[model samples]
Target: MARAPVLAAGGIVLRRQATPLIAVVRLRKRNEWVLPKGKLDDGETPRAAAEREVLEETGHEVSVHEFLGTLVYDSGGRCKVVHYWRMEAGDEPAYELMYDIKAVDWLPLEDALDRLSREHERAFLENVGPIALKAAALDGAARRKAAKPATRRPRRTVAPPPSVSEPDTVPAQFDAQVTQEEPRSTTEAAEPAISAPAAAESQIPPSFASDIEPVVIDAVPMRPSHASRRNLIQRVRDWLRRAA
Candidate 1:
């Protein structure tokens, strides 16, 4: 025959003062300080019952995070499994205690670890201790930051104070741009803005003749041929013989 397991829920509830403390409650009948855990009511979820139980037993409002596994042990003939969470307690529970809880006290987590009656509960604390410690440290840091006053940052300096000459030059340039007076019109009109080569070209005189020969190499007539010289000599000899 299989044994039916009893389901229960509770928390590792932490509250911070100078240092963070875990909430461990003393049981009236058992005369032991243990993490608060109880069997679920009809139609109650483990998480919901855990929250309700902590409120009822310890009188502290808690916001729970991380379902921190379970512990199962045989109680007499029946097996029992208890689920746990890492819960952060608020200012007030706003509810009255109504069960086996005699007193709930916040003690340093290390002390509470040692104080827990069950070895199983202490093992659970050991597993989740680092996470709880980190949360507490972060919470403490945030509170410190919030409480600290904000400081005003110093204004940035830019350009240094202007020199006397710099101020004088600025007005001179401004006056020259905005209301600059031109000198009285002179006999020589303002010179045209032209390149040096272009000005030289404009100064050159225009040529009238189109086919003029250059002074360096003049044109000349063709020289006499050898045939013309020989013909002239023969004509002279014939004329002299006839006259004699």
Candidate 2:
């Protein structure tokens, strides 16, 4: 009967920087430098195993992303299939390295390719390194774009509406006439002097004037007797006859 293949999982883990770096581990038993990977634990998924193995080997917490390709190779007369995912590590390590790993090295893609002990792992990294690097670079750019502050437009200054002038109340000619008049004294105001022509025009009629005879008026006025009143009336009748 044919034996089942040994299933393992790992990552192409990157530490974000100006130029990103990848993680590689030195094996304690074999003294060989290799990509971080391990066989799955009981009831553990491939993706979960990949995250756990990467954290254990690299001693840094990581965020796992899209899956890369798989690697099928023969190890000790058995088929070993390893799955890899793209992952990003934090700025600092969160835990100590596992007992199986002696030391961890962070390096650029070409150097990591040269340092890896196995021929298959190196070949796999070369094919997928550029893809992972590009993806990480895009992610970093997106984050920076989100963090940048937005520009604000300046406010407009509105000028106040033009002032309206009120119309004049009094006419120009009337105002000038009023301003030109001279002030009068108390004596002139009390007895106003009339012109000769005005006084002549205001005189009484000739008929009435002739009839007004000069009669002596006493200082103290007394009531006339009936006989004196009759005499006065007779004199008025005689005057009327003469005028006619």
Candidate 3:
């Protein structure tokens, strides 16, 4: 009997920056890095699955934007079809992973293009590379454009500084112009006005002894063996291992 096709959905969760970045996830056991994706559950829509899987696998809450394309291939005697969408990630840390996902990386567009394992994924990305980059970068100059304008484009050159033929001592000239506009008092002109925070603090009322409450926080007693510190160190190590 022929193996049934498994339907799944995923996202290329991206963040807009100086260089557009795409989020990729690593499996804990296999140590393979790939785009966040998962099999669709019963009654789950492709877009919904894509958003859900991204959050679950990568812990990033992404807003689904444009649909890239479906990648269909045979794996382990079963045909798998993954529908991918371009998504924008929120400016927040991902939720905690369930330990299956080891690490999440937000790599630049070109780096991510090279990072993806599958050739089909690479090809699909290459096919929609320009559009994907344009969508990822919401600006005109930042967009990964393939076709140049019909007219010959001029190379960007640094602008020349303006030549100023003014009177000698520009600082003295500015001082004279300022004096002409506003006349300062003899004392004001003699010394610069120094503002102090203490003047503002005077506005605040002084605290009284009656405002302080007589309360005590119970402190836990430590054992002579320092078992708590050892446990804490081990826990920190475990957390670090998982994070790495």
Candidate 2: TM-score?
Answer: 0.65
Candidate numbers, best TM-score first, in rank order: 2, 1, 3
Q: Which ten residues in a row have the lowest lDDT in candidate 3?
A: 193-202
lDDT string, candidate 2, 28-139, tens digits: 9999999999999999999999999999999999999989989999999899999999999998999999999999999999999999999999999999999999989998
lDDT score, candidate 3: 0.75
Error of 3 at 101 (Å): 0.9
Runs in model 2 with CA error above 4 Å? 158-244
Off by over 4 Å in 1: 139-244
Q: Which ten residues in a row have the lowest lDDT in candidate 1?
A: 208-217
lDDT of 2 at 213: 56
State the number of backbone clashes in model 3.
0
lDDT of 1 by residue, 136-192 (tens): 688668989999999989989898976756553456777787666655455334434
In candidate 3, stretches whose alpha carbon ends up further than 4 angstroms from where it belongs are: 138-244
lDDT of candidate 3 over 1-244, digit per residue (tens): 8867999999877777767778878888888778889999999999999889889987767778889888888878899999999888876766887588988888886887788777877776677666777766654454435455566789999899766777565688889898898977788775543322334334445453235344433445668688867565555454334333
TM-score per candidate: 0.60, 0.65, 0.54
Q: Give me the candidate number with maximum lDDT.
A: 2
Q: What is the C-alpha lDDT of each candidate?
A: 0.76, 0.87, 0.75
